[model samples]
Target: MIEDLQKYYGYLFEEALLKEIADVAIAKDIKANDIIIDIGSYITSIPLLLSGAIKILREDKEGDDLVLYYIEKGDTCAMTLSCCMGETKSKIKAVAETDVRLLMIPKQKMSEWLSKYKSWQEFILHSYHNRLQEFIDAVDTIAFLNMDQRLLKYLKDKALVNHNDIITVTHQQIANDLHTSRVVISRLLKALEKRHKIELHRNQIKLLEL
Candidate 1:
């Protein structure tokens, strides 16, 4: 685990700081679809992803979830940082999108590192900036883009994040992520197929073009 940390975060921090992180961070492995954080839950630690991916989601009052963005290897969840710093509950949810390994730093250690290590401060700030940009992009997509365009973009993103052109997902799952009806998603997917943008099969989509 220390070696993995060094591989991902070595250049970002000094040797001493890296050592401190290795000593204090708790390493854990999680399976796909595991809920890492839930809405309104207190965050006691911040995770540094070592491998695989996590999908950050926002849940509505009606218990619907919308995909916000993905945090993959070498990334951290900025929402976790916000909750830890403010000692507040998390409004967003994080779920493992694939089998994942991560190192968790306790809230106290996270606070201490921010003050003690310049690199740590920079890392946190960078994560916040990236997440904010992603949020802005999502807002623009929802407000300006049509559903077909949005579905295409979503598929492209999922393909890129998973590093596979063939996506294993159901139309209903895509509908849930896009906050639309399964029938609508199915129709749009068929339209995409007619345009030669993708190939659809039972519960899977093979992206043929962007």
Candidate 2:
């Protein structure tokens, strides 16, 4: 666990802080598609990603989820930090995009370490900045891009995060992430297939010229 912590976070934290984290943080392994955080749940810890990817989502009024972005290894979720600091229930959902390894630090340590460690404070602030930019990108994708373009970006992102060109996912799952109907997703996916951007299989989509 210490080696994993140092591997992912050494550059961002001091040796003493890293040691403390290894001692106190609970190391966890989450399988793909598992819920890391759920809407309306009280967040109790902050996760420092060790490996794999997690997708952050926002729920719409009709209870559909819209993918915001994916966080890979060596990243911490800003939404989790916010929930910890504000002492509020989570408004976002974090789902494991791949089998994941992470360290969960007690939420109370967030404030304590913020004042105690310079690196911790800087890391938190930087995480927030990065997350805000991702949110802006998500908004831009929804507002400026066409549905097909959005779907293309989504597929590329999934491939990138999963570290595989061949993504194992269904059209209906894509629809759920994009907040659209499965029929619409299936139609657009076939169009992409015709354009030679992707190859559709039984339940998977292989990225091509994308």
Candidate 3:
């Protein structure tokens, strides 16, 4: 796990410098379908992805998951940023997409390390900036994209997670993600399937190549 971290960020840091930060890392196992962190909760820790994937999301008023993004290998789940900023609440829930292993770091400890470790500090700063940008992009997409385009984009993006041409996202989940009605999503999906643009496989969809 440390090797993957080093490989990903080695260009930005000296080997000895990164090793000192990695020394404080600890691993945790999360079962598939488990909630790694709940929405509206408090957190003072962050998790570095070691294996598998995670979904950062929240439920709509109708109680369906809305996927914000996928956190895969070598990524960091930094819910504690808001917590540290005194938000006192999490904006999203994080769930294990598969059985996952993570390196847990306490927020205070990470801050202390960053004060002494320039490379690690820069990595954290960059990650926070990227996350903020992602949120902004999401807001823009929601404001501008139609339901079909939004769903299409999501399927294309999530296809990488499934490791197949097919994607296993439910219509209800799509509705939540797109902030639309399930009936509307169903009608659009059916039309797309008939047009041979996609193949519906129960809850999953296989997007046809253009």
Candidate 4:
């Protein structure tokens, strides 16, 4: 665990801070599609990603989840930071996008380490800024782009995140994440294929332009 922590996060903190984190943090592994945190759940700890990716989602009024962002290796959920410091229930849901390894730090250490380590303070602030920008980008994509454009962007983003141009996903899964119907997603996917933006297989979509 100490070696994993250093491999992922050593560059972000000093030797002393890294040592403290390894000593105090509890490590855990979660399988893909598992819920790490659910809406209204008490957040006792903040997770630092050691490997794989976690998708952060926001629930709509109708109990539908909308994908907000992805936290990859070396990243932490900024919303978790706010919930931890506020001592409140998690408002957003976090799900493992792939099999993931995480380091959970007790919420009480947030302030303690914030004031004690300059690197920790900067890390927290930087996380907040990144999340804020992702929120803005999500809004802009939804408000200004058409459904097809949004679909294309979504595929491109997924490809970039997974580090593969070929994304293995079903149209139904895409619909669920985008909060739409499978039929609609299927139509859009075929249209994209005709446009040469992507190549559709039985259960995979290979990005061509991106």
- Candidate lDDT (C-alpha), each: 0.92, 0.94, 0.74, 0.91
The TM-score of predicted model 4 comes to 0.97
Candidate No. with top lDDT: 2
Report the C-alpha lDDT of model 4 over 110-204, residue by residue, as the tens digit: 89999999999999999999999998998998899999999999998888777889998999889988889999999999999999999999899
Worst 10 residues of 1 by lDDT: 1-10
Worst 10 residues of 2 by lDDT: 1-10
Q: Give a tens-digit lDDT track for model 3, residues 79-176.
A: 55657556487878898877888877667767676777787788778778777776776777677988777777777766766556787778887777
Clashing pairs in 1: none
TM per candidate comes to 0.98, 0.97, 0.82, 0.97
Q: What's the lDDT for residue 171 in model 3?
A: 86
User: Which stretches of model 1 miss by more than 4 angstroms?
Assistant: none
**Winner by TM-score between candidate 3 and candidate 1:** 1
Q: Could you report the Cα RMSD, in angstroms, for every candidate shown?
A: 0.9, 0.9, 2.8, 0.9
Off by over 4 Å in 3: 1-13, 17-22, 59-65, 85-87
C-alpha displacement of 54 in model 3, angstroms? 2.1
> Any runs in candidate 4 off by more than 4 Å, and if so which?
none
Residue 163 in candidate 4, Cα distance off native in Å: 1.3
